[model samples]
Every structure is written in structure tokens, then in C-alpha cells.
Target chain A: MLSNKKTTNEKEIQKLIEELDNIISKKENILEINLDEKIRKLAELLSSSNSLEEINNCSEAIQRLAVIIFEKTKALKNRSGILYIDPFLMKLAILGSNIEKLSKAFIQSWRPVVGRDVINLFLLKDAMTYWNSITKYSFEAREEKTIENVSKISFLDERGINEEIEEMYNELERRGGKELYDKLIESKNLSEKIFKAVILSFMITYGYVGIIREPLKGKVWVVKKEKTIESKNPESFVIVVK
Target chain B: MEEESTKKLRRAAQLLFFKSHRNPGIKGWELRKALGQDYTKILKKLEEKINELGLTIKIVSDSGELRTLSDPHEVLSNCRFFISINDPLTITDLRTSGWSIDEIAGLTVCIATIISKEGKTTRQELEQILSQKLPKWKATRLLSKYIKAGYLDEKEDYIVLGWRTKSEVDLENIIRYIFS
Candidate 1:
């Protein structure tokens, strides 16, 4: 296990070095060209970040800047989301897009979706099956397999996620008014907050990073991502809560 | 007087044993059903003769399968000895003598086999293969111990037999002498 951990750490270090080189090359490209304001600002922010310590500390800030870059790019070219798209819908789209982008950006910018996201997910699932075998041998829990039991985990399609956001907006309209929506729109860190929340959900629940669980246990409850918010009874937050 | 009966019983018992390993926990009725030629009488005779050998059998409730925890290692060892005086010592017999020579032998065989195939081997590759296939911590811990004990030599990603001066150890020789 220690060897495995060491190997994984080595792999991560190698990947980090490669990614730093790629980002450096991009910075050099930006410097060479007469860059737009957005690219110029991004390049300035990326400068002087070569060491692992700086990279680890500034990565979240870099991602935040990337979100701003994305927004600014959209503003320059009046395409789908930034200018007129519903703010809630915009957040949903970015949430989906950022998960894909961050995963891609971390793995080497070349391989999209890691080319086998679902397969990798399934392999992680198989690791759990091995755990089950170990527990079975130990005579831990002799519970019968619940065959034909429909699970409560209903994964929403992209369309469904978008619709859910739209429905949230509709609920806000019914409960409060355009005033609350405008207030939410005014919050500068809204997108960043949403991204952070989404990432937290991914890390804690989705095994997107890797499921870390106790080695030996009879009954275990895995965390999962949820699309609900419990607090803030005001109009703007109603969409997410419902 | 009943030596012929005992021989028939042993033959039937071996058949039943093989069937159990193939399909564990078979019931008496199912065993009878399986024995098509004079099924009932032959099963009864077999059961009576087996009881005479002082081997008790029972049926498990949940699976309704025949279960027996009789001394299989002893039986196998005795059979091998009867077949030939040079049966050598079984791993269990070695284990009962208060040392785990079998485990060390097994590790030696593994190192030899890997070296033969990969030509050269390393500690990392050995750890990876052992951790992936065998019991993770135990195999790696043992491998490291073997390395420390001069049973294995590491070279990058290749592993080879350490101080043992065997120019060529075939797989059969590995299994028979090293692992046995």
C-alpha cells in the first residue's frame, strides 16, 4: 500500500510538471501575440508560478481567473450564456463544464473527458466489489442481496439539470420577484461560489477524486452529490432548495 | 473379511469427495439421485461402509449440501506415502513442525519464475505484481524480507534469485524443490 501510494504521488508529480510546462508555453504564446485584455490579465496572473507550493496555493485562484476569462470571452462575443442567458441556467452550464474542464486540465489538457470517464468510474465501482468480497469472507454482514430493488439514485441528464435550474428560477419568480433575482445577479462571486460548491460535492461524494473509506466495515454509507440547498427561504434561493 | 467392502467404500468415498469439491454441500438425497445405477442401495451401502471408517458426515441446513470436515491433509499425505516411499514432506507437515518453510519456498519460486520470464526484475515490479495479485501487505512485506534475507536481488524493474547459484532453474524444479 505504501508503494502504491508512492507510485501515485510520483505520477501526480510528473503530471504536475507536464501541466506547468504546458501552461508556461501558453503564457509565452500570450506574451508573443498582441493579446486581448482578458488574455493579458490571465497571463499576468499566471506569471511567477513555477514551484509546486505556488502551484498548489494559486491553482484555485487560477481556476477562478479562468472562470472570469470564460465570462469575459463570452461578453466580447455575445454568444449563448454571459450576456442574456438566465443566470441560474448559466451557473448550471458552468457547473457541468467546469467539472469536465478541471478534470481535463488536471489530467493533461489533451485527453478530453479522460477519454473514459465512465469506464474509470466503473472501475472504481469494481474496487468496492472487492471490498464486499473481503467483508463476506469475514462473515461481517450476512444480508441477502436486494435483487430488484430500485435505488433512489436518479441521475439527471444535462437537459434535466438545466430544467431543474429553470424550475428554480420559476419558483423564485412565484415566491419573491425580479428584485431578488437581480440581487443574486449582482453578487460578483456567484459563479465562483457555485463552482466551489459543485467541486466540494464532487470531492466529498462522487469519488471523482477517489473514494477513501475505512478498509474493514460491516455497513458503509457512501456520500453522493445532491442538487438541493436547504437554507435561505428568500425568493432567489428557492429554486435550488425545491 | 470385509477388506473388499472397504476398498469399494474408499473408491465411492473418493468419488463423493471429488463431486463435493466440484459442487460443494450436496445432500444425501441428491447424492443418491446422482448415483443412477442401483442408486438407493449403493448409496446406503456406501454410507454404511464410510461410517465403518469412522468418518462422520452431516448435511448443512441452509444449502442442504453434504458437509464433511474430515482430515483431508492427512488423507492426502497418507495416500501419497502409500503410493511411494519418496513422497517427500508436505507443506502442512512442514508447517506443523513450527516453521513456515513453505512460504519462503513459495516466495523463492515466485522470484525465480518472474526472473525467468522477465529476464531481470526489480523490487517495484515485484511489489506491484504481488500487491495486485496476492495479499498486498503480506506479499510485499515477505518480498522485502526475502530481499533482506538474500533470497532475491532487485535491479530496476526486474527481480532475480539472490545468492542461490542455480544457472538455470526450470519451472518444474522451482515448484518441486524451491516451493515444495
Candidate 2:
């Protein structure tokens, strides 16, 4: 009867050792194994063993089992939550030979979030109201000093057109034809300056004045033409009046 | 008073639907300032109203975790509120939204690999895994796109799931489907 009991204990120890081996080899999921049950069975076996060799064998199995449990518990404690992944499934799906199949599997499961940007009248109105409330400064209308109407200098009128051109030419000649274009057009009133610029353009157009621009120096010299000669090729250039 | 409440509800809906910040959601305090102190009640009403339209409002905590309305008002106030479709999109819908199969597959691989690695992995490791199926350059570019789109985040050398993934993707269900 004692021999029969010894054999049973030996068989149970062998089965437990095989289970532990499967877990250690990662053939079975560590999380799925009943660790507490294994420990209890091992404790029962240790208590029932008749020989010193059997006790020693049971203690060794228990020590190995304790180490496995300790490692697993430490890993679990480190994890924030239970995000379990089946190692076999991961290998088969992600590291599998067929990547297209993995993609299809993802497509089958993906549920993308749906949200769109939208603008509505209600939103616009709220925005406007918010803007109006926060904007404390009123746009004060300072009376823009009305450009005082200077006596009409009509360069376009045929009656005074020649007189205007001649006056501009004589002025250019008086200034030694080397007056900077800006100095010639400079006036206290903006309108008067613009008027002078317009007349200067006409003077250039009629061949009474020629502008030599030193682009590097950014200076324009209104050289008086020695003789009035109609421009064979009159290229239009812009003269901005400040 | 009824008219005032209706106007507040409209204002709340408009605030949520029209994104004003760099991100797609509005903060709880902004809603309170717009809709009044009873913003939580207003949000609840707005949530019900949107639910009928097959839309839903999701609240994400400041730490990027999803929160429900059942959370305390103070907690909800600190959270971000955004709207999304209640139902998942079909594959055809995904294609229509300009997602290619390869890109989808690549994203799946990244998300799955990250989850397997306890929600974090090194960028070099992820790239190596991706390079098996895709060209090295393509994998690198795809990872950048994912990071930019808030699907994955890069912290120094480590890559973790992004806020958008936490708000949108159902990780558990995705894993189950992959195995299935």
C-alpha cells in the first residue's frame, strides 16, 4: 500500500513538472494557468510524500513555480492596465507571411471617428457679438483735412497745354536740367506735388525734358532736352508721386 | 425662460460643432462661460439631441483619458468635449475618406505592435517591424504621418498611442477582430 501511494505521488509530481515546463517554454499562456491550484497541489504532494527524495523533488518543483509566479506578478504590477495580447495571434497576424491578410483584418475592424468642421449663421452671429462686446475703442472719425482745392491748373486743356509745357521746360532749364525729379515735384500740399508730377510727365512725353535715372543712386535727373524732338519710341514708365 | 434655455442649447451645439482651438474640441470652462454655469446640464441636453442625429459627444480628460457624463461636474468641466459619429465607418467609407489599403494596413500594424509592447515601443523597433512589409523610407514617412495625425505620439525615442487614438479607437475590439 505504501509503494502504491509513492507511485501516485511520483506520477502527480511528473504531471506538475510537465505543466511547469509547458508554461516555462511559453507553449501555454502564463495568465491562463491556475497558479494557485498548482501551488496547492504541490503543497499537498509535499505533505503526503513518504521518502526524502520525493520531498526534495516536490520542493524543487515548488521553488521553480514560485519563481515563475514572482516574475509574472512583477510584470503585472508594472503594467497600468490589462492589455493582453496573444503572442501566437500577434505572430500569425502581424508577423505572418501574408501582410495583405493582416491589412484586410484591420480594415474589417477599423471604425474611424467622424467629425467635421462646420460654420453656421448662429456661430457667425455669436462671433460677431463677442467681437463687438470686447472691442472697447470706438473708431473715432478725425476730420480728414479736406485737400484745399488749389486754383485749377489744367494741363489737359488745349488752350493752356502749350503754355504749361513751355513753363515746365523753362523751369527744367532754369534748374540746369539736373534737379532731382523728387525735388522738382516736392510741394507742401500733396495735390500740388501730384500736379507738378503730371506736368513733368507731359514735359518728358513732349520731348521738352528727359529723365536720366541713376538706379544705383536712386536719383532721377530731369535733363533739359537741347532741342525738342518727338520720341521715336516712347516707352511708358510710371513715376509715383508721394 | 424656455426661450432662454433653447437659445443656450443652440449656443452649446454651435460651440461644439465649430472648432475654434488648434485641436478639434472645446474646453468645459469655455462652454460654461458661453452657456452659463449650468453647462453640464446644457451639455447633457445637447448630447441627447445629437444622439438622435446619430452623433455623440465624447469628453476626454486633461490627461487624455475618456470620461463619461457620470463623472463629477468639476471633473467634466476640466475635460474637453468633442463630437463624433456614433457608428463605426465601413471599409468603403474609409476609402472614400482618402485612406488607402496599404496605409490602413500600416496603421494597423503600428497600433497592434504598440499595444503588444505594453502601450509603448521604441521608434527604431517599430520601424524595423514595418520595414519587413514596406520600404524603409515609406515606413518612416507613414510613421511621421501617423504622429502628425495624432494616431501615434513620439516622446524622445519612444512611441506611444496618441490622444486621438485614446478618444477614437476601440483597442480591445480591434484586438479581438484581428485574432478572429
Candidate 3:
């Protein structure tokens, strides 16, 4: 019975070494990631190498880091403050290993409020939007690209609520908003119809005017139409929504 | 990698298409009304996926114009392959298309109504008849209605036997029948 007990303990020690080696493989290249003070103390215990108590302590530290990463992702999405969107996406792309249950658990931890379905929907939509913008990026040289896209797209903390509405009013004055607005407002549900009209009118205008983008920040969807029908559909001509 | 993305999108498309078909013969406008503004973009993405899957979508407009009213009712009728309308494609339609009803419903009485000796009805014909003649009932509801009405008999497939009119049964004693 004593010999059997010794063999079981040896097997458990071997399993602990394998788990630590796997964890280190992922962190090897990430040089700046200093272990937390608590984690450092745990590592001191782990230096003894074969102690079962040290293995348990190291496991606790790994669990803590996972929880921290999960919480940080959730907090970033909720409070929008110029998050490095691309880098954030890169981290997300690396998630989900061969283990299905672990990946699901990780996603569940990261997005507590939004369910998996909602995250999937947003990811798909966002991916399409991102790919569309990236297609526009191929024109410029490499070094100047990052500065142009990322640096320009940053937003200020304070902006007027009516600024968006005023921009529309100004554009209308220059390009006969009266004629378009009058027809749009004629619908019984004026408010609802105006929203549709605004969206339609802008799409028509942009289709004629090539949209400009300012990298990492955000890009406008612009489509430039041919010259023939330009004047006939002036409302359908150059439009900028943002 | 692109092929994988295309496959993912196709799976998503099947979900969207099947879900939209639950309301079979649903128009783009009706889908917009039901699913909100995202329907057009969602469908456009699905169409892109279908194209990636080596399928060509010919946008056959009723009139050659910039904008024409799309009749989903007509589209569903004309489209036969991998296409669906607002109504759920019944077990009967699937059976006629060479799928065993048992595959989907398992061992059950598959009840469907056919118009007086018509072997099988297209979705368009069924919709029109259900809406005009049987205005009170919906097409999906007819599965149960015909079953209870004794107009539809269930076996390996749904067989529509003729319905018994009230007047024909009491033809000999009209006065007594009316009084009773």
C-alpha cells in the first residue's frame, strides 16, 4: 500500500510540471508581463519544484491572471475611451484553443452582460465593417499609414448633442434641403419617414462622392457615381453624414 | 481561410433563410417590417455567401426600372430550389421533393390538404386558395383544419379525399334537415 501511494504522488508531481511548462510556453515572448506581487510570492514557493503545496499555489496565481484578463476586456468595451481597437481584436483572435469548454468559459467571463449570440452578431458585423475599411487602406505606403489611420481617428471627450443635427441643417441650406425635407415631411409619420429619407438621401449623395478615410480612427462609406445623372439627382449627389 | 469564412457565412445564411421561411413568402419589405432595418444588409451578406458557394443570383425584376415594387409572393412562387417564402415548407412539399417525411417528422401522420384531386399544390396556389376561399384560416393552419374536416386522410403521405358538403347529405329531407 505504501509503494502504491508513493507511485500516485510521483505521477501527480509529473502532471504539475507539464502544466507549468505549458503556461510558460505562452508567456515566453511576452517579456514585459511582470508577474503580480502575489504571483511572485507564489513563484518563490514553486522554486522548491516538487512540493504539492507549491503547485497548488501556482495554480491559484494562474487562475487570478485569467480572471484579471477577463474583467479588463469587459470593462474596456463598456467604457469607451479610444480603445486600441485593432490590438484588442488581435487578443480576441488568439482566444479559443483546441479545448471547446475552456474557450467558451473564457468568452463567458469576458462578456458577462452580452450573451454569446449577441457577441457573435456584433463580431460578424464589426468584422465586415473592418474588412471594408481595410480594402481602402492598401493605397498608401506602410509607415505613414499607421499615423494617418490611428492618430486622426481619436475623438475629443466633449461634443455638442445638437452638432450632428446642425451639420445636417447646414448641408441642407447649401444643397436645397427644403425641397427634399418638404417631400419627406409630407408622409403622415413625418419623424419616421424623415429618418428614412435622410439615410436614403445621404446614400445617394455619397455614391457620387468618393468617401475619405482617416485610418485606425474610422472611415466613411462613400460611393462615387457617374457624371451623367449628376444634376438631375443633386440630392443624390455628394453627401457626408459624419 | 477565405473558404472557411465562406463556409461560416453559408451556415449563417441557412439559419437566416430558414428563419425567414418560417414566415414563408415574406417580402423584403415584410422582412424589413418584421426583422427591422437590418434585413436588407443581412440578406445582401447572405447573397454574397451564396455567390461564394458558386451559386448565381439573377435579380429578375418584374419591370426594368431603377426601383420596382418587389412582390415576395410572386418570388416565392417562382423560386423552387434552395428558396423559400414566408410560409413554412410543409412535410407534403418536402415529400414531393423526394425527402421522406419520416426523416423530419419521424413516424407520424403527415396531414396535408390538396384542392379536389390535385395531386400536389405549389406554394403560390396554396397561398391564394387559403387567402381568398378560406380567408379565415392561414395556410399553415390548414394542416390541422383539413385533418379535422375529414378532407385529408393520412397514410404514407397526405391524401386529400373529397369533402362532404352539408346540403348533399340532407338532399332527400331538406325541410326536416333545415328544421332540425
Candidate 4:
């Protein structure tokens, strides 16, 4: 009679396991399952059974049920304000619709925050005081050796620079209106080559010439600008004489 | 005494409406310092005053979620307060507020995607989802814009709903309207 009872208990535990699996794997709404009752039944079976296999199966089922319950509770907590819709269906709806319609749908549900930003007299006064304090301290000028060298270079004056740039622009135009930067600076004397590069930079800066540096091709070209466009924003780049 | 209370109410309104920080809205402590210890009471009065103009005050907790005034006094004091419209906005209103149609559509896709994924998704996943409806470049740009606008938060790789979304957007209604 005791042996017969053990067989019945084992069969019942197996049945419960199958049911729990079905509920977990097949049901869309986990809330519909009475997971608490299932857990209670598993506990009762676990205590009554002397057989090791039946006890193990019951414990495992209870653990799986407990995990599902925990997940459901967490999901519910996170979704306190929002409703749950199938993610796949939501993606379908979003992808199937046109932008205009989707935007209209979104606006129908959006409540934008509205606030004002004002600059009052106190704020303006505070700003003025801060500015005044900052302006009281001027930036100190630092003397560098480069400044002395630049000062000695008399040809760097703004007055005659424009005419020299014009002459270089004419020379570039005579040479097919476009010449390789390296070729333009090619000379036996290193000083002369450096001087020519300096002039080329001035021409590029004054908008009389444009430099096209193809870093990938390892080449630089100096193209004459058809019109003397004012270089309001000049970009600087280095060209190796070698 | 009535005149004093009225002045405090005006000060509270200014603090809530005028942005004094990088983020919109004023902290509860700042309000306390500016309007005295009875700042919550003043905010209650301000809520009533703004209600007439179809506007309302929103208090968000330090955790970046909306909180009711019924919370503990300490929690309430730590919360941030801002003004928001009482009613839902129309498309025309959004346009006037400087949001382009593509931007509105893109933001909707992003928010909905994040919510559907249990309130968090990856940046790459979001970008891929958005690229379906927009050019890859535009999709990337729009994602950054939404993040900057406080509609979405980025934590390393994950993208979660932001404080602005919590206070302003009706996530339930957005889902319902879209499915409907």
C-alpha cells in the first residue's frame, strides 16, 4: 500500500510539472495562471513525499513558478503608468505608417512643458557687476622670441602685401592657372624655397589663390581663384618643403 | 499678511517659470531659500493661479520620476518643480514650438521603442530602428537631439525614458493612440 501511494505521488508531481511548463511557455498573460496555488500544491507535495526524485521535481517546479511571479511583479512595477502592448505589434504599426501620420499620432498624446524665461533687473544688474569685475583685470601680454623675429620681417606689412599677392596671383595664372605646390617651391637654395612658400601662403590667405591638399594622394596643388574673393575665414595648413 | 503671501506667490512663480539652471525648473531647496520654509504652500497657491491660464506645476523626484506633493516633506523639498501645459498639444502647437514634422515622428518612434522594450534599449538598437523610417545620418542626428532635449536619457549603451518624458508625455495614451 505504501509503494502504491509513492507511485501515485510521483505521477501527480509529473503532471504538475507538465502543467507549469504549459502555463509558462504557452500562456500570453501570466497573470491568468494561479501561480500561488501551484506553488502551494508543490510545497505540499514536497513535504509529503519521501521519494527523492518526486521531491526534486516538485522543488524545481516551484522555483520556476517563483521566477515567473517575480518577473511579473517587476514588469508591473516598471509599467505602472504605461500599458503593455506586444512589442512585435508595436514595431509593425510604427514601421507600416507614414511619417506624417505617425507624427500626428504622437502630437495627439504629447503635453509639452511650458515655462517662461525672463531677464529681470536684478539679474541684469548682477550680470553687469560680474562683467565689470572681469573687465577690471586685463590679460597680460607675454613677449616671445617669435614676436621679435616677426617684427624684423618688414615685408610682413599689410600695406604692400596686397600688391605682392596680386603679382603672385598673375604668375600662377601664367603657369596654367594651377601648379603643384611642391613644384612652385622647388629651388636649389633652401632660403629661396622657404621665401616662395611664405609668399604662397600669403596668396592663399588673401583669397588670390586656393590650396588643395590631398593628404591621401600625398600631393598639394595651388589653384588661382578666378575672382579675388575675400577670405573672411582663412584656414591654415602646413606644407613640407622637402 | 495677505500682501506678504501674495508677494511670496509671485516669487515662487518666477522661480518655477524662469530657468535659472542648465536644466529647466528650480530645485525645492532653491525655492525654500528664495521663498522661505513655506515654499510648498506657495507652490500650491501658484498651482491654483496657473490653472486659470491652462498651465500647471510638475514636481519631479530626484530619481527622475514625477512625485505627488503628498510625499514626505523632505522628499518634496528635494524634488524639482516646473510649469507645464495642462492640456495635450496639437500638431500646430508643436510646429510653433519649433519641432519639425520629421523630428516629431522620429521622437515618437524612439520613445515608443524604448517603452516597448521595458523602458530601456541600446543606442545601436534605437538607431537601427529609426533608420527604417529615416536616412541613417538623419536618424543618428535625431537621436542625439532627443537626448539633448531631455526626452531620452543615455547611460553608456542603454537609452531610457528621461525626466522630461515622465513629466510631459502620456506614455499610455501614446501607445493607445498608435495601436488604435
Candidate 5:
């Protein structure tokens, strides 16, 4: 992964350096040309380019292409929701951004989606599906939480989880079925809340307790059920007075 | 069964098992790191040798990714319905709160894209597409949820299918569900 990063970084650096040189060398190259003319010229280059690789090879054109595409996409973003993208523009973004190609075709041939402001959103989907697999597994896979790792949970084992739930039940019993929306979470952290809620849910599903919340009042009545006999700690429980 | 082939099979299994557990799958270059550049051959050899270990390796045609397969029949049989009712209920809960569409759609998009491209794409790219297509906030919300739910995985720069879907549902059934 680190090595791939270096190679990619090198490529991106090379592309950026080339782009920077083009922008810096004013006398040798006409860097201060009109923006519209530049866009049209780049668009023509893209339209005429035989392959995506060939398009990519022209780093200056790809960089200039990104500016126009970025402007267009940004303008489109103001609308409520429409993920339209020109395939060539997307390819320009991909090439310009220096994303690794997943396709076997040495050059992805993108025909222009002409006469349309928004193209099929699927093109973006395709690009994402291809590039994310490479980026994720290669870069972020180790950090991603998985069942095997998240489920490792040594400090919060089954018995420990059950004990935590039992404590909640005890508090509910003392409060005589506490009011509705009792934040099941004792801690501020959302993970802690979710964990506690999950354990409490198990206790409820096992039939030891039941909660009835009023639809309008948003108040809950905790009722001790018949399965109280299974409790390791038996207490005088209050049934919700409906 | 701990011969040289078995050892390699186990190592490959340890490597690829959790990865193929979902809808979008892992690409070859990504796996090449741990398994080495010649991991493709190793995967093929393991594929030929791993029936006894209760796993199978498959190559995703579009993305050219390697994924592990578990018998759906055995998985269904082993699932204790009485204890695991939360599995479906959780989906229900997510649905009630509007997380399921993102989960289901994200899963569907990745599957469709994988089939469409015959190649893998980065999660950032998927998110980029989604950010364009859907409401920006909605897309952002869904991407994170999908990743968290294990319905979608973020690979090196790509997003592949995750393990949760691989174990829980049949691929064809899910595709059907998405369409219907």
C-alpha cells in the first residue's frame, strides 16, 4: 500500500510539476490565453483525443479541463438533486485527480453524451466502484471496523453486557416504569448508548420486561413480565399502570 | 489437512474471508500487497484446494477482485432464528429511521456498477457520483452509514462489497430485491 502510494504520489507530483511549469513559463508558452478559448481548445483536444490515456498524457489540457468541469459541476450543484456528469469530464477529473485505473482496457473510450446537461449518474457510480475498491483495500481496509474485530469486545462480554442491562432494569423497577424517552444511554458517547441499547433489547426480547410508550405523550411504562423468574437478581418489580 | 497447500489455503482464507463478506468486492492490486504481486496465482491455487476448509474463492469479473464464498445453505441452516431475530429487526429499525434506502441503494449501486464496469471503483468515486446525484447531505449520510453497516467497504481508493451481505443474503435475491 505504501509503495503504491509512492508510485501514485510520484505520478501526481510529476503531473502537478508539469502543470506548474506550464503555468510558470509565460514567455515560452502562451499561459495567459483567454479562458473561454482555452476551455474550447481543451474540449476540442478531448473530443479529438483517441484514448483516455492520450488525454491523460496531455497533463496541461487535463488540468485546464478540470477547471471548466469543476465550474460546470459547481454551478449544477445549486439544483436540489441531479448527479449528471459528462463522461469525458468525469474521465478528465479521474485523470487529472490521478486516480488509479481498475479497467483492463489501456484506454477507456468515453463517447460524449452530447446534447445533455446531465448524463446518466451511472458513470459516476462506475468510476466510484472501480476506484474505491483500489483505494479502500489498499489504504483504509485495516482501519475499517469488521465483525471479527468489533465482535472481539473483551471488556464487554456477554455476562458483562447482561449485568449492565440488569442495572437498567433495576432502575426502571425503582422508578415504577420511568417516563417515556428515557435515554437508554447513561454515557454521552453514541457508541456506549448503542451498546447499552442493544443489551437492553436482548433483555426485553427474552421476555423479562416490556415497555409501552404513549403515542402522543411520549411517556413509557415499563412492565415486568412473566419471565421475571429467569432473573438472577429477583426484585419486587412494578408493573406499568396503564 | 495441514499440508503446504492447506497452509496456503488457510493463509489466503484468513486474508480474503472478511473482505468478500459483502456486495462490492476487493480488487487484485489491493490484495497483491499482503499476498505479494503473484497473489493472483496463489489465489487460484487456493481456490483449487480450499473446499475442505468450508470456503471458496471467486473472481469478480468486472472489478477483477477476489472474494471468498460460503455456502448459503449452511449459513441459513446455522442461523438460530430465535436468538437472531434482531438481524431483520435491525434492518426494520434502520428503515423506520431512513437508513435502509442508503444501505440498500449503496449496495445496489455498487453491485450494479461492479456488473457495469466489470471492474472495481474507489469508494470516493462512488461517493463523488452519489454526491452529484443525490442531495449532498443525504449522500454523505448514506455513504457513512453504508460503510458502518458493513454493507459497503472502502478499499484502498475503491469501495467493494462487504462481508455482512455476503453472509446474510443471496446475491441474485438482492439484485431482484433492488429492481422490484
Candidate 6:
């Protein structure tokens, strides 16, 4: 048991010596270090000659310095501060930094009232929430005639909705999806548009339908992403609030 | 001789990068004195370690306050995430002790309010600010906890960034998120 303990101590001492050697080797680049008091004390305890492997206490000190060094290096790496900002964010950050410096200077000079700022902050947040509740809209107004035009060209074969399934698909499929929206949704808003828009937005938002805006043609079209062989048939969405 | 040179380089790297109890980072002059020559060679080697990782040590000013390069959000975003916006350090300390969750929620808003406005505030200023909001003894104890952990540096009387918080954290990222 005593021999095994000695071996362990020897191994630890050897490890410490190797670590010190590694640090000591880079003399050209390394600046003079202000050694930690504990590290200095440990160095005093260690002999300059060989047979450091025989000393058990050396293991403890070496391990302590190791932990401290590791923590510092880890913190530095974690800073991630040593990075080049990607091009776009860099330009934006330059403007941001200038503004930040100016704002800091202004605040320091002005010595703004804390209480008023706090009150204003609460008021601003409240006002923003109120405005959002009043003004956020789901979809634009489009006439029901657009939907009728789409129904004429497109066929949904699943729910007994299309009378001429293959006929409609074959007819429209020839036009290469161009007439899908160009000839269909060109009409302006007519009556009962709100109800149709609400239903359409609900379907689009819930992934039951998708709208593609093609900038090339300056038109928007709806597409049904049909389920592939691997996909399970989707169930109807029921809104759940808990 | 080659091995000795390598060792010095490694030792210098450790001292330059590590946070000492007394200072945030090593100064450039001290580094120059150690190597008995220009510090650039050592800095170059250090740069080699981080270049591939998309990180470089930035020597802020001539003082050598080293910080890594990153987007504002990436810079100390973790610190911002960890610091609770509503609760004061007092509340956090009390809860750590035997104080109940219910007790923490209702403390005077003075500590957080004063610190936010002043940026770097002293213990006396905090006490005076919260003299009406909470007990003096309670505030002192809370501030002590933060100081001991190096979360807040109590330099003489003024509170500045602690060694642990030298990470350059800011709510600017929050502003960017909100406005963007």
C-alpha cells in the first residue's frame, strides 16, 4: 500500500514538472509573470534537483495551481470577445458604438431624473401594448371572387369538393403555375371579403395552406404542400390554452 | 535553450490571460519587462491559439485590458441572462439565506433603481438611496455577498466592475433585440 501511494505521488510530481517545463520553454513570448503567492510558496517547497517525484506535498500544490490556471483560461475562452465581427454587423456596430458613446456623454452631463424615467418607461410599455392590441391585423382584404377563380382552376380531390378533379388539374398544370395567381387574385375587394380573408389567414397561419409571393412575377399564390409517403396524415388543429 | 524559451512563453500567456485577484488583466509594460524585449512575439503566439477559433484578444487602450472580439449579443450575453431584471441583489442574497420567496418579491425597489441610474455606485450611496426603502444592515449584508463573490468591486467607496464581471456585459443587446 505504501509503495502504491509513493507511485501515485511520483506520477503527480512528474506531471507537475512537465507542466512547469512547458510554461518555462516559451521564454521569448512570455512576459515576466507576477506569480501567485501560493504558486511561489509551492516553488520554494520543490527542489531544483531531480527526485521531485519522491515528494508527496508537491502533488497538492501543483494541482492547486493547475485548477487556478484552468479556471482563468476557461474564463478567457468563454469571453468569446476575441472575434472579428461579421461584415454586416460590424458596420452596424460602428454606428451603434458612436451612438452609445454620445448617449453616455449626454446622460453623464444631463444627470436625468430617475423617477421620471422609470415612470415614463412603465407608461411607454403600457402604451405600446395598447397600440399593438388596437392595430395588429391578420390579412389584407380580397374579394371572394378570387377564391371562386382559384376553385375553378385548382382541384382538391380528397373531400368530395371537386367535381372535375383530373380535368381541372390537367387544365391548370399545363400553364406551369403562372396562371395560378396572375389570372385568379387580380380582382379588388368586394363584399363579404372580411370573412373570406379571416378563413384564408387562419388556414395559412396554421400550416393548412401556404402563400408564396413571387417577386419575379409580382404576384402571390397559394400552394398546398401535399403529404409525402413518409408523412403521417395531419389531424385537424384544435387550439389549446392552458 | 529552446525548451526554456517555450516555457517562458507559456507562463507569460497564463499571466496575461488569467484574472488576478488584484487586477482584471496584465498590463503591456509588465509583459514587456518580463520577456526583456517586445511583447509582440508573445502576443503573436497567443493570437495563433485563438485565430482558428474566430477569436482574437483585443488590447483595449494602452492599459492592456484584454477582451475577446464578438458581436454585442455574444459579448457577455450570459451575464445579462443571469442577472434578473426585476429582483435586486438583496433579494437574491436573502433568498439564498433563509428568506422566503414571498419576502423577496416586496423589497424596496431602491437598490436596482439607484444602481441602474448611477452605473457605478458606492455602498454609502446605495444605503442612502434605500434609507427609506429597506433596513441599512440588510443592504450592507447583501452588498457584501456580491463583493465577496467578485460580482461587484467595492473600490474604496465606489462600486465598479468586479473581476468576475469584467466580461463587459450590457443591456445594449436587449435594446438591439427590442428595436430590431
- DockQ, every prediction: 0.01, 0.17, 0.02, 0.32, 0.02, 0.02
**How much TM-score does chain B earn in each model?**
0.36, 0.93, 0.25, 0.94, 0.41, 0.45
After TM-score superposition, the amount by which residue B165's alpha carbon in candidate 5 deviates from its true location, in angstroms, is: 1.8
Error of 2 at B175 (Å): 0.7
> What is the lDDT for A242 in model 2?
46
Candidate 5's residue-wise lDDT over B78-122, tens digit each? Answer: 221100111122333443434343445444555444433323566
Q: Give the better candidate number (1 or 2) by DockQ.
A: 2
Give the whole-model CA lDDT for all candidates, comma-separated: 0.37, 0.72, 0.35, 0.74, 0.44, 0.40
| Model 1 interface RMSD over true interface Cα atoms | 28.7
lDDT of 4 at A121: 67
TM-score ranking of the models: 4, 2, 6, 5, 1, 3
Per-candidate TM-score against the hidden true structure:
0.19, 0.51, 0.16, 0.57, 0.23, 0.26
Q: Give the TM-score of candidate 6.
A: 0.26
Off by over 4 Å in 6: A1-242, B1-5, B17-24, B51-118, B122-139, B155-158, B162-171, B174-180
Q: Put down candidate 6 lDDT per residue, A1-242, tens digits, no spaces.
A: 66776566466566666655556554322223344654765565465324544555586557656755665565445334422123344334323433233233222221110111223343556556545433234243232424354444334322322333323333334555234433432235522233233334434444544444422122345454333122122223221111
lDDT of 2 by residue, B1-180 (tens): 999999999988878877665357777888888888788888899899889987888888856688987788788887878887777666666658676767877888888888887678987787888898899887887887777677787643478887777776777766766766
Tell me the TM-score of model 2. 0.51
Stretch of 10 with least lDDT, candidate 6 chain A: A108-117
Q: Candidate 2 at residue B172, lDDT? A: 74
Q: Which stretches of candidate 1 lie over 4 Å from their true place?
A: A1-242, B1-88, B96-102, B105-109, B165-172, B175-180
lDDT tens per residue, model 1, A5-86 = 5455445544544554455446432223332543444354346445565456446445544544554464445433222333
- Model 4: per-residue lDDT, tens digit, B41-76? 888888988899988888877566777656677887
Q: After superposition, how far is residue A95 of candidate 5 from its true place, in Å?
A: 24
lDDT of 1 by residue, B65-166 (tens): 222333242222211000001122344444443325534333543443453343345555555544543466666666655554434555333566543212
Query: Where in model 2 is the C-alpha error above 4 Å?
Result: A1-74, A77-82, A86-89, A97-114, A117-242
Clashing pairs in 2: none
